[model samples]
Target chain A: GAGVSQSPRYKVAKRGQDVALRCDPISGHVSLFWYQQALGQGPEFLTYFQNEAQLDKSGLPSDRFFAERPEGSVSTLKIQRTQQEDSAVYLCASSLFGQVIYEQYFGPGTRLTVT
Target chain B: QQPVQSPQAVILREGEDAVINCSSSKALYSVHWYRQKHGEAPVFLMILLKGGEQKGHEKISASFNEKKQQSSLYLTASQLSYSGTYFCGTEFQGGSEKLVFGKGTKLTVNP
Candidate 1:
C-alpha cells in the first residue's frame, strides 16, 4: 500500500499571506497528526485528530493556524496571515489506532517559506 | 517539555561505541527513538515503554528509566550506516499520544 502523502512539497508565501497545506493519511488510519519542524530542531506537535473529531488542538501556536479533517480522511492545515516564524516544514502523520501504539507513519512534509 | 539530549553531536570510529541520553522533567509512559538522515522524515527505530525494559536491534539497544524520566540509546560496533541524527520522543504516561521530541544528537560514524 502507499504511505502517507502531502502536497506541494514546498511553498513560498509572502508575509501576511495565507497558505493551505494538504495531507492524505494512509487509508483507513484513525489517528492523524500535524507537526512543525524548524531547521536544526526536532519536529513539534501542532495538532491531532481522531477520525473527523480533533482530539487535541492545544499545540496550535496561534489563532492563525487552523486544521480540519473533514470526512475523517484528508486533512488540511491552513495558516492565515503567515509570518516569518511560520516558515518551517509542516509534517503530517497517521497511526493505526489511538495512543496504544508507538508507530506513526510520517509524510515527506511541506516545506513552507514565509518571506 | 523538550527533553535534554547530551553530546549535541558526536563522531565515532567504526567498531566503537556511543551513548545518547534524553531526560525530561515530566514522568513519561514511553520513549521513542528515531534516526533521521539528512533531508528525510524521521524513521522509527524502537519504543521503550515505561519501566526498565531493554530491547536490542542488531547491536543497538536502549534503556528506559521510569523514575527519572530518562532514556539512553547505546550503539555498539558502530557502522558507517549508523551516521545520522538521533532523536528521543517522549509521551507522558497517561495522555493523548503526542510525542514531545528533544533537540536531536547528530552522530557521524567514520570507517
Candidate 2:
C-alpha cells in the first residue's frame, strides 16, 4: 500500500511570500496531522484533522498558519507570509482511525526554506 | 509539555545492547516510539498505552510506566540498520489528540 505522500519535496521562497504544502493521506485514513521539524530537533505538532473536521489547531504557531481538509482526504497547509523562522521540514501523517492510540504513517515531508 | 529523552546520543557496535529512556512531567495516556533517518519520515516502532503495558517489535522492545510517566526502549543485539534518531511522543491524559515529541536520541550502531 502506498504511504502518505507530500508534494514538492523541496521549496524555496523569499521572505514575506506565501507558501502552500500539500499532503495526501492513505486511501482509508480518517485522521491526518501536520508537524514542523527544525534542524536537529524532533517534529512539533502543528494541527490535526479528523475526516473533514479540524479537530485541533492549537499547535499552529500563529494566525499566518492555516490548514484545511475539505474532502477528508487531501490536506493543505498554507502560510500567508513566510519567514526565516518557518524554514523547516513540514511532515504529514495519517492514521487508519481518528483515535490517539492508532499508529500514524508519516510522509517523506516537504522541506521549505525561507530566505 | 514535551517529553525528555536521556542520552542525547549513543553509539554501539553490532550485536551490542542499548537502552533509551523518555520521561514526562504530565500524566500520560500513551507513549509512542519512532525511528527516523536523515531527511526521511519517521517510522513507527510501537505504542505503549497506559496500565504500564510493554510491547515488542523484532529485537526492539519498550515498556511504559504509567505511574512514573516514563517509558524505556530496549534494543538487543543492535544492527547497523538500527542507526537513526529515536523519538518518544507523549499523549497526555484528558483527550489530547496531539503528540508532544521529545528532542530525540540519536543511535549509531556500527558493524
Candidate 3:
C-alpha cells in the first residue's frame, strides 16, 4: 500500500508570498495531521482533520497559516504572507482511524523556505 | 505541552546499554516511542499505557511510571543501526488526536 505522500518536496518563496503544500493521505485514512519541524527541532503539531472535518487547528501559529482537507483523502496547508521565520519542513501524517493510539504514517515532507 | 527528555545527546559503544527518559508535567494516557534515522521518517518502537506493564520491541523495552509521570526506554546490547534520534510522544486525555513530542535525543552508537 502507498504511504502518505506530499508534493513539491522543496519550495522557495519570497517574503510576503503565499505557498501551498499538498498532502495525499493513504486511502481511507480517517485521520490526517500536519506538523512543522524547524531545523534541529522536533516536529510541532499544526493542525488535524478527521474525515472532511477539521477537528483541531489550535496548533496553527497564526492567521496566515491555514489548512484544509475537503474530500477527506487529500489535505493542503497554505501559508499566506510567508516570512523568513516560516522556513521549516512541513510534514503530513495519516492513520487508520481517528484514534491517537494508532501509529501514524508520515510523508517525506516539503521543505519551505522564504527568502 | 512538550515532554522533557534527559541526555539531549548520548554516545554509546556497540553492545553497551543506554537508557533514555521522558517526563511530562501533566498526566498522560499513553506514551509512544519512535526512532528517526537521518533523512528518514520516524518508525514506531512501542507504546506503553498508564499501567505498569512494559512493552518490548526487539530488545528495546519501555516502561511507564504512573506515579512520576515518566517513561524510560531500555536498549540492551546496542547496535550501530540504533544510531538515531529518539522521541517520546505523549497522548493527553480525551483522545483528541494530538500528540506532543519531545525535542528528541540523539544517540550515536559506535563500533
lDDT of each: 0.92, 0.96, 0.90
DockQ of each: 0.68, 0.91, 0.72
Expressed as tens digits, the lDDT of each residue in A1-115 for candidate 2 is: 8999998899999999999999999999999999999999999999999999999999999999999999999999999889999999999999999897899999999999999
The per-candidate TM-score of the B chain, in the order shown, comes to 0.97, 0.98, 0.97
Tens digit per residue, CA lDDT, model 1, A23-54: 99999999999999999999899999999999
Evaluate residue A59 in candidate 2 and report its C-alpha lDDT on the 0 to 100 scale.
91
Alpha-carbon deviation at A42 in model 3, angstroms: 1.2
Q: What tens-digit string does per-residue lDDT give for candidate 3 at A1-115? A: 8888999899999999999999999999999999998877778999989999999999999999999998889999999999999999998989889887888888988999899
Lowest-sum lDDT 10-residue window in model 2 chain A? A96-105
Top candidate by lDDT: 2
Please tell me the TM-score of chain A for candidate 2. 0.98
Residue A3, model 1: lDDT of 92
Clashes of 2: 0
Which of candidates 1 and 3 reaches a greater DockQ? 3
Point out the worst 10-residue segment of candidate 1 chain A by lDDT: A96-105
On DockQ, who's better, 2 or 3?
A: 2
TM, every model = 0.96, 0.99, 0.96
